[model samples]
Target: MTDIGIVGAGAAAAAATYVIDGALPDASITVFEKSGGLCGRAATRRRGDVTYDYGANYLKDDDDRVVDLVSTFDDGLVEVAGDIHVFDRSGTVSEGRDADERKWTYRTGLTRLAKHLFGATDATVHRRTRVERIARSDGAWTLTDDDGGTRGPFDVLLLNPPAPQTATLLETADWDAAARDDLLAATRDVDYRTVWTAVLGYPFELDRPYYALVNTDKEHDVGWVAREECKPGHVPDGESVLVVQANHEWSVERYDADPARNVADLADHAAALLDDERLADPAWTDHQGWRYALPESGLRRGARTPAEDAGCYVLGDWVAGEARLHAAVRNGLDTGERIVHAR
Candidate 1:
């Protein structure tokens, strides 16, 4: 039987797990996720009667294969309502920038995408188990977690954490030193944009023409502001939830600042852009800081060949050269196929 090990339970990892489990029915698959959550930055949270996707706004219908994959389990799928409008650094809103494709999320939230994929697999997933070390011995891979526990001695290993985190693991791994160094250098070269997000809940409804606003030039302090109420079943009737994300520069500056102050500042930006005073003081607030939020660039071509040759694969949107959620799933599907064929 094929023995497989995977790290991270993001969308890509979940998709890979599903594919691998189906292809190799006798495979013993294991996964370790650092957080209690799945789907990485496509995260969601609920408070009282409201559910919001505070990380990735929505999944874009850009990839045909991913669209087909998601369509197989079409339950709870909901389209995000309204057009996307553009905003300039001066806070001027425009009507020209509507989406060319559809935006989608589940009635529950985006995390359901990962859940549906993983639920079909027999892979044993260990959540809140952070894999702190990686080692290769006896032609097998093993992992050491934060709690001093070890897992593996598997024939194949898949590293699915962000490039930086994956790089750190590779740098300290006990494996073929030359191959590890090559992978480590490629992983470390990937740069990311940080994002600090604030979710504001208002008791009153917000009347707006667009579901979301984007900073086209990337010069604005607030990067993107999305209306959570536009998604079906996300918010209660006559109430609203706004997700405000600060730009990379702004996020880096206040990433270590007080949470209350960051929320207040982001709320002020939202109020100014929306031209509504009530937004300046939200009824309730929530916030998240993503240090390696969006990958600015991907790894060099064929840089992972050495590792892949040794039954080690790294998959994600960054590895696919696209920062979209669909790209990550597409990469995952392809990676799973590769592993199956290799066996």
Candidate 2:
């Protein structure tokens, strides 16, 4: 029987382990991941000889905890000077001081960051395990898998799943009326926007700026166009990779449409913005949808009832601030510290 059981293998869970291990050295830790791999939204995909960051793009230096954690890894990350180009609806590219701020990305891909977090600890990470329900019985917490298999009577249980999915899990578990109401109340007001990322790879370079942050008045959206070659180890000398993020409004309008057609249309729109018609055709192209891409509101109140008296905690970017990668990591570290202090 493990002392602590965590749901999800994202940064939050990894940070929780880092905290719990130090606080409760004798306790065993186990993390259950629904997917076949770790890194929930921080996903990376490889195409032929190039790797693409399909999920998170980069991290800000202002995030202290995140910076410290990332520094622990030896992966090559080039410092990005804010020399970004912001294109408005009129096709006017404005140059500003905002481009001078520093950012960072992996030389290979975002997966290197996930692997670094996982390597920091010895937590028992179980991939491909879908946690269906979490309940407290006989003074201990029981987590059930999809097949109704009971995992254990864990002393503590931490839930870090996305807010929408977390609501479903809380509904299945037996809890006091007030506790359930509080959990529901805290999450009810939180809304999220969906993001559609269209990734494409080409054998030739488009002789424009490396990054184009576009604001479209027609769609009232923000599209982030990044040159993959700007990062290290992405492609060969002449080839380049590009990623376009559709604005919230545009993504919502076509959230349920055919993915291929949606990607084609988005690619066309992006190509028009860049004045490069060649982008319509690429050697490789794909689209990924993020349902809960950004958090609408911050978490209302602290203190979540963790499976009866098991003393589990809840934390995520929603609780800290926006749904940025840095915020998530900060929330995770904070949750870990709180758990440790409680112990």
lDDT of 2 by residue, 1-343 (tens): 3478888887677777886776677878888889886666777778777877777776666677788887877568766433577777665556533555566777667666656776767678888899999887665678999888998778778887888877788778865556666776777667887888899888897676555465544344546677767766776779978888887877887888898888788778767767789887777788888888778787675536432234656667776658777787788888887777766
lDDT of 1: 0.91
Model 2 — which ten-residue stretch has the worst lDDT?
Answer: 301-310
Best by lDDT: 1
Note the Cα lDDT for every prediction shown: 0.91, 0.73
Judge candidate 2 against the unseen true structure and give its global Cα lDDT, from 0 to 1.
0.73
Error of 2 at 339 (Å): 0.6
The count of residue-pair clashes in candidate 1 stands at 0
Error at 194, model 1, angstroms: 0.1
Score every model by TM-score.
Answer: 0.98, 0.91
